[model samples]
Target: MVAVRLSADSNGVLETPRDGDRMSAISRRALLTTTAGAAAGLAVAGCGAAGGGKQGAPRAQRTGEHSGASGARAPAKTVRLIGDGSTADTGPQPNQPVVDRLEPGQTPPQFVVFSWDGAGEVGNGLFPRFRKLADDHGATMTFNLSGLYLLPEDKKLMYAPPNGPLGASDIGYLSDEHIRMTLDNLRQAWTAGHEIATHFNGHFCAGSGSVSRWTPADWKSEIDQAVAFVTQWKTNTGWYDEEPLPFDYAKNLIGSRTPCLLGQDNLLPTAAAIGWRYDTSNPGGDQIWPSKRMGVWDYPLQLIPFPGHSFEVLSMDYNMLANQSHAATSSDPRNYPGWRSQATASYIAGFQRAYETNRAPFFIGNHFEEWNGGIYMDAVEETLKHIAAQGYKDVRMVSFQQLTDWLDAQDPALLDKLRTLEVGEQPPGGWKEFLGQVPASTATGGAGEGAAPAVTATT
Candidate 1:
């Protein structure tokens, strides 16, 4: 969940609008607060994130299992366990598409990333539900797992968040059973070709200890702790009988979305220092092509079309709920149907705006919760199915890491040209004419240039 500071005018209209006024007039129904109950409920209910697979494309065989071109079977996977045997170094991830540079005249794929926050199970079956949904639609996604979710409640004080109480976290720690479930899902998600990123731990979104005020050092400490929790879960839980997570998280973690979208400004410096590829913590970004921030990709939650409203909302489920039901988790049930439809339309509108025009990547953030009779979840499902029905080979539903792979493969000049496209604006004379002439000499640091970096299936 990204953090936002929205204020309405006397007429109750959102301020400082942009993207052709799409960001204007969002109803001032409620102040999107980061209350302890809301944060803890999101974590206790299901404190983790999710990933998906791309539709219409054949899943790639795991690297080390076959020759890339000849299709010849290769050697078996070699798994080397890491610290405390909580994680391992498996070969390339399975089902990863072979990323290549876009040829001249080739239109870029419509990349849609559906990420979950606080991705925990908690007996709700949402983790598996979305996993199955991704498989069914051939989409790949990013699951932002909260480190605290894996830390046993008994060991809660083990966490030391900056400026916050030692071992204190706004989000609740998971039960032992739920921790095991989260681990199981994470292992499966990794093997099945989804990206597992971090959501940090102890969501502190307000007051003096809020992540919004954390410094670079504080951010680094948080990141290090998050990594330790993920890599040392075995020590924390003493559940040696459980299977180790299938990938080396230290290497696999190339990106993250901060809790409640806080602390990104400080987090980016640490993220770049630690060699992370991207951060998706910025809120209220327009639906335009992304660019690097502090040398890392900045994939912000965008302002998208909101049905029945003159303004736009952040492309997130909770933001929608904030505008629709004023942040009340359980609103009037009779209004659920209309609210659900509005949410679905809003998502679809956001997708269509990007798909039909600038072709910027569409990102949607979610948490596994039954907010407002679970309409948001239903709306997300409907939106994914609708997108899948398009059946366009160029409409790629990929994870953040996978998208990074593609971005790194492109000519920087071509990317610059792509960035010129404003929200809902099309290429001057269509994609072929627009991107076909990007000078080969201008590739600069792009992978399409000489001596492309050695890319593996894992990243």
Candidate 2:
């Protein structure tokens, strides 16, 4: 039987499982303390100040992945310093002024809104419009395409027949025609610069119930197959060179939102072992929390509990919106136009509140197939526009893997700042703290256009 465990800390409630389980809980406080100690140690070592006399000036270079289209290498000037005088290392070089400053208790930098449940009965014929909406909002969404949708000929055969190794009914079965259409649609989206990741070949229910039931090898094959299919499609469509298939260019089929968000505890650790860096399956509902596992990040879909049945309420709204949009006419007042106006208003209001309060990256989660077509489409576009107007600049629309890469590339200084704050420290009851700190600007040597002086301190 699958076991689950929930724990609370300064960030929010975190659900993980027992040892040896797929998911693990991390204490924000513990993480901060650990990070702080490490930073302090590094600072002392770098300066050679711990032993007595000063050492040769430590190297000025910082290391991490660059944020660019070609994955080309670029120098990062800002580095995270730890210890008593870490901040002293940073100062305004000759001509430059610090434009942005981060104080203690600030929320972490950047917010992301990710969508799941793309492909299959719900997502078929709906993605084109959805893609448009995502584009309009300047938001990056991950379409966790179900693998069953990739098989065209014997679509039903993709699902494990009853009495097969995976006992329960297949949750994401789709018609062969629908599968091919969805594949084509996804290719279009990818070419247009959207992220397409995996939701799993069998969905969440596929590997639920017991670990003994599914081996590591089974899990690997399931994930590998999805990666292989997408990679092959890119090649077939001439997206990559035909002669020497760009295996390196293969998208890091890394993001996953479990079917039903059910088997997250089981899926997370398994994913990590197989090289995934992020999972968006947990349903914390509006609150953002870092994952316990260090390498992977958890972008939980925020769901707020209401007086009435919450899921039922959301489901009803989804269906209503879907139907209204699907049947909407250009002139219908209570149809597409009405839903767009209302949803946009709500999304803007919510986003503003989150931004002002420094609790952002607002997540609006829904199955691709659940809504009335026109209404859903309209809501998506309006929401996108509203967000853009709200001054959310440089929003990175990326896949789950890209998110992880971004996180991995975080300026050690940013992480150091979070570490110094002491993970679980909360501001006074009435005060709102901004935890999102922007990285220090990189330094360009030899005085080029917009170049600043190079200042290095030895203490």
RMSD of each: 7.7, 17.9
Off by over 4 Å in 1: 9-76, 442-459
Give all candidates' CA lDDT scores: 0.72, 0.39
TM-score, every prediction: 0.85, 0.54
Candidate 1 per-residue lDDT, tens place, 262-379, comes to 6678888888888887888875578998888877888988888877766676778877776776666777999899999998998999999999999999999888777788899999
lDDT by residue (tens digit), candidate 2, 1-459: 111223433332234333344322212111100000111001000000000000121111111111121111212333232222101112111111112333343444445564645443222335555555554544445667655454433323434422245322234334444443454455334433445566655433223432224454555666775555444543223323211111122333666765435445656667777656677766444433343343456676553321212121121123223223321122254454556555555455545555544333455554443223345445555655666665755343344544444444444454443433321233234232333333453432111222223332211
Worst 10 residues of 2 by lDDT: 44-53
Residue 342 displacement (Å), model 2: 6.8
* Clash counts for all predictions: 18, 21
Off-target runs (Cα >4 Å) in candidate 2 are: 1-110, 120-125, 153-176, 204-218, 228-251, 292-294, 304-346, 370-377, 394-399, 412-459
Top candidate (TM-score): 1
Backbone clashes, candidate 1: 18
